[model samples]
Target: MGQALALREDFDGSDLRRLARGSRDADQTRRLLALAVIYAGGSRAEAARTGGVGRQIVRDWVMRFNAEGPEGLITRKAPGSPSKLNDVQRAALVQVVERGPNPKVDGVVRWRLLDLAAWVWDRFGISLSEATLSRELKALGFSKLSARPRHYAQDADAIDAFKKTSRPAWRMSARRSRPAPR
Candidate 1:
């Protein structure tokens, strides 16, 4: 094999062990301990055995440690898939949702997740599933809200009149059914 990579001059075996002791991340602690072994005059193969990784990974760790110190060993969250909608498209979607759907033009009074997904496909030519669109909408600070169903022909005035007339009858019946206090 070729010559082993040099560890950073600033840190020694004791410093690495101390850092490992203070580290909250388990992976970072393990990496630091393995590097500490190398710093204490252990071979790359021994360090790899200590880390439970191959010699190649131990070399990579050495490189990372040399470059960025202990912090480089901490694991980072992976960035998942890119958003299907850009800022302009997202803003337009927000505006469309806030403005509400038109029954005549959009053929729907209320917007469903599927309807919004279709609209996104039609307008931006990007296909998004309802669940994915819902997640996107949630990320954009939008929540699903649906109004309680009401009959189109229901009379508010008649309902109010009935409520006004029914209460006195209900109270009278209740009074008649209750026994007199001894």
Candidate 2:
């Protein structure tokens, strides 16, 4: 039920126990609750009420149980595509980064993700996508480092003098402007 009450109905057959053994998903738990309520002589409405799902869903599971029993409660997995990189490739990539600076191609010092991906494919012969490679690096406590422009006042005295003398007097500008012809 939506509200918690301390009513203990006569539940049987360890359906909930076995469902708990399978997976901790909400669907499996709901199915088990439905079976427990209805199979133990509780009404379809009462089953839905106790299980906190709609009456029709409870009735459906009851019908499914009647047809296939406990095995009927098994939930199907969500369909999807498979992953790209395997454990071995991930390990090799991580090792290369942790070992530090990459070899010079044309004299650029450090390695980027594409460079790492290329190196990984060349050395270990395992092609890892840049996205997956980034995830692996983050999981291993590595973060991207970048540089910011620094304002280094090398000669503060010279800079201060330049700023002070940089402006022309208002009187000088006024003197430089020729009056409009009458």
Candidate 3:
């Protein structure tokens, strides 16, 4: 024999339907909601069982509509605004700071943050603060190496002699791949 019908809790489904009907969410949500009202309980109470949404979701929609009105139904707040520097600009900045500004140009071995910032401003026309420039270079895959002093002869022949005999650790022949064919 069929059991007696389950008495629905005092919840009135019309309240939720009325609120959902006037909401401003994209038409799709409104349509789904009409169906949910039936599935939830107003008509059949099947929507709540299958949609995984609590039957109280209908009440939530009504309450939300009352508090914020319509547009509150849609979700928002995605992330925004990425870095201003593009890949090539970032790469050039990193290369200039980490490896460019050779001794011939800067008159010294290492790069300085202030100098790098100036160089970046000149090249990219975007003035980068010193701390920002440092952080950017690091972000672009470069790291700082501490500076050390070096003394070298200006004369090519003197430099050659120094390389060959004075600085035994720096043998030029070791750097040469092989003797050219005769």
Candidate 4:
């Protein structure tokens, strides 16, 4: 068997436990507690069990702790794929959205996500779903807004006058519906 791993002499079990308690991250707290157990002469396997991980994981943690201290115990984010649309394209898209669509050229008065997706496909050869296009537009600070539909010949003044004058004959109806007295 290999030689045992050594923890820093300055830190004891209590100090490790205190650090664990102070940590906001649960994983970091668990790793600190595991290291505390190891510092108290517990085996790597026991430390792994305490930390809820495999023995190899405990070994890795110990190495990180030795090299980088408590800061190294925290988890890091995984790098994902880059966005499909580049900065220049996104900026252009924003300007186009701000300008609105041309009814004569685009065939539609409003820019629907479906229309935008089709435009993107035609302009850049990028196939985009309506939902994806919507999400991208929202991320660029655009919100869904549609004008209320009304007939072209509708008069707002007439509608307001009708609302003011219209009243159901509730008093006559109530008198007619009264039961005959005994």
**TM-score for each candidate, following the candidate numbering:** 0.78, 0.41, 0.37, 0.68
lDDT of 1 by residue, 1-182 (tens): 69989999999999999999999999999999999999999999999999999999999999898889889999879999998889999999999999999999999989999899989999999999998999999999988888998999999998887774434444345676889999
Write the residue-wise lDDT of candidate 4 on 1-182 in tens digits: 87766776777888989999999999999999999998888888889899999988888898888888888888868787566787787898898888989999988888888888888888888888888888788888999998787889999898987785657657555775889889
Error of 2 at 147 (Å): 4.1
**Cα lDDT listed for each candidate:** 0.92, 0.67, 0.59, 0.86
- For model 2 the local lDDT of residue 63 reads 60
Supply the TM-score for candidate 4.
0.68
What's the ranking of the predictions by TM-score, best on top? 1, 4, 2, 3
lDDT of 1: 0.92
lDDT of 2 by residue, 36-148 (tens): 66556677678788778787677677666666656676787778655556778668767767676645652335768888877877777777888877877887688897555
Per-candidate Cα RMSD to the true structure, in Å, reads 6.5, 13.3, 16.8, 6.2
User: Per lDDT, what order, best first?
Assistant: 1, 4, 2, 3
Off by over 4 Å in 2: 1-29, 41-92, 102-107, 147-182
lDDT leader: 1
Clashes in model 4: which pairs?
none
Where model 3 places Cα greater than 4 Å from the true spot, the runs are: 1-81, 104-108, 153-182
